[model samples]
Target: MTKKIVVLGVSGSGKSLIGKNIADKLDYPFFDGDDFHCQANVDKMRQGTPLTDEDRKDWLATLNTILTDNPTAVIACSGLKPEYRAMLRKGLDDITMIYLKGTIDTIWQRHQKRDGHYFNGREMLESQFATLVEPEKDEALVIDISQDASAVLNEALSLLSKK
Candidate 1:
């Protein structure tokens, strides 16, 4: 089975970490939406400026294309809003949506540990949370990311088998 998976959450929710694990487990390719951001958007984030919807428009479209273009892969993206998720699913019905859920305090702690990443705007995490619209139960497999990465990966893989 060719699987197209997207692990979504706000910054520092461990989407990328777990996305990579999921891809490895399934022997599928892994992509980080962050890697596809335009230089301008990267600059904005690097300057502690939150990217507006305008800044994200092209990047989101690119990610959408990547998912649609790939045969089988797992992607990690900060799919904060419903519109963003919709764009990602615009014409694809088989995409597996996984939402990494955690609290502000939990994710904040993890976010602070990150090193040499462009998304260094610690204050932006709050903005990401404010913009986030969590997927409903019917739309995605929601995984709690307050635990260790291995535990979270096991939980997601376990739920995925039943999905």
Candidate 2:
């Protein structure tokens, strides 16, 4: 069956980069979770304010719509909370989540070099990691991003192949 994979992690965990390669390898459409954000949300993050659950409510709804519309796509999202992931899972049963795991130091290094996005420096990273509720069930793949990107992607691909 075709799958809608949610590549999830805190910022700077390589969710976007890994998601892109996975989508390319699986021949699925790719979506950046950042693109689903509203300008207000973007502005808030740019100002270094962490998003409240209320702030993320509509954004999660929008993502649900996108995944509902394109069932064969792979999306890279922060999806820090289980509630947020559950929101994305609504109306979509054929979904899989890949949690790209990493340590604070690993993420901080990558975050320092990020460009052209609302999140700058280490503020959001701290908030995201703090908010993160790692997947604990069988429906999720907890792959550490501490390794090379190719290694992470390859492991994800192998898991997808099984599904």
Q: Whole-model Cα lDDT per candidate?
A: 0.89, 0.88
Give stretches of model 2 more than 4 Å off.
Answer: none
Candidate 1 per-residue lDDT, tens place, 127-149, comes to 89888999998878898887899
The 10-residue segment with the lowest total lDDT in model 1: 117-126
Quote the lDDT for 138 in model 2. 79
lDDT of 2 by residue, 43-108 (tens): 989999999999999999988888999858899988888899999899888998999989999989
What lDDT score is found at residue 15 in candidate 2?
92
Return the clash pairs for model 2, or none.
Answer: none
